[model samples]
Target: MDSKNYIDSGILELYVYGALSEKESMEVSQALQQHPEIRAEVEAIERSLTQLSTAAAPYQPDQVYQQIKTKLNFKDQEVAMIPITRKRTNWPAYIGWAASVALLIGLFIQFDKNKELRQEVVQSQIEKNLLEGKIQVAEEDLTKTKTILSVLRNKDVIEVPLQAQQVAPEAYAAVYWDKESQTAYIDVAGLPTPPPGKVYQVWSLKLDPLTPTSLGTLDSFNEEATKVFALNNANESEAFGITLEPEGGSESPTMEQLYTLGVVNS
Candidate 1:
């Protein structure tokens, strides 16, 4: 393209504005080198833009810009207009960047430590809840024990010993009968745990015709931690016997499965 025509096309303005692609900029640079007039036009455009930019900026004292540089901790820039003995390193820039890196590292460490502390606090709360649950269970067990002891020590309680019978010679039990209240507490600590779907039934026996009356069943033999069970017994009893039967008590005592027999003292 001819120099006058290229200048008139406004491509030089685009070039000055850095709006051209790399290849296009190279082409323009080459054209400017070959045509002195194109180079002069580009320079004129740059000078006018620079003057306009200076005029658009609000007036400020030289000290205002210098104070801004001081706050930024900017060091003395290289003076190309004056000769220097040696190339000066920008120490302020290096120190500022190092301080920023150190500050970031410290913040990261603090954040990690806080996260770890939060996890530890959560773990502690879990352990505290578990300990409190255990303490509650223990307190309940102690309360039951105190109640059993108080029942045994009553003046109205009648103590009776049950001897092991033919079925289980090793088994022995005691009956604490509160005659006033018609409540009999059977201590079956020596009795073995009954099989699944089976339970022990107690009988209040009469001596003459050898009649037996059901006094309910000992249902929770396995889980009775103190091995003591309370049953309602209001019969004019002569003897007490325990026999293993089905889940619910049998219609009459099963003599074959008799584990213990005790005759009440007269």
Candidate 2:
């Protein structure tokens, strides 16, 4: 039943008066637990019943002392004597309530501890996932590195070493050409980092009549982790050359800014 309906039904008064069956009383106890309004109503009824019982019951046990003193021949002192009664401290009631309060406090402390432990467990799981993701990325990078290394170290690949040129004497680079795949992998690890507003552009030189075909530009030179770049090369390249060109690269090799050059040995 709803709180309002249950309260108006007068079952709470019966429950408090011990007039209800055990099952009915249990039902009321459960309702009181679920609804604060029902609990409040039941408490008010219990208080009223207690007050009625107290008022009806003879509260003066002092009359017994008066009769005892009269029988002991204290009749002359009766007229001048004042009645005094000291209420005994209910130790059993105090201990029972104190124990109940202690138990409630212990439960509250345990609940807080459990909540903290659960949060710690959740945080640990988040950290574990983060670590696992990093490990996965590291493994992927390792696999990529191994694959690139194997391609560069292939016996059939033609290795061309480009020497430093006039524009940048300290710069150097190497090209690993796969004739079958018509591709070239340029290892620019030895090349000096490019200046701002400029990038390193590679070329496939025919050497005869000085024909230089644009291969591609190393756009992310500084950002590349391995400093190796891949380019499609279908030309019958007789030589390879690298030049420092404007950011987007030049239509042809910038002869003045030529950083490295190497002729392929047929």
Best by lDDT: 2
Which 10 consecutive positions of candidate 1 have the poorest summed lDDT?
78-87
> What local distance difference test score does each model get?
0.79, 0.81
Model 2 spans with C-alpha error above 4 angstroms: 1-133
The list of candidate 1 runs beyond 4 A from truth reads 1-22, 25-133
The most accurate candidate by TM-score is 1
Please give, for residues 1-266, the per-residue lDDT of candidate 2 as tens digits: 67787787666755664545667778899998999999999889767645644445433334533544454446656534633223433333555567689989999999999999999999999999999999998897787688678887799999999999988888889999999999999999988888799999999998769999999999988877888888999999999999999999999988999999998988
Residue lDDT tens for model 1, 199-249: 999888998989999988988788778888888999988889999999989
* Model 2 poorest 10 in a row by lDDT: 82-91
Residue 58 in candidate 1 has what lDDT? 33
The count of backbone overlaps in candidate 1 is 0
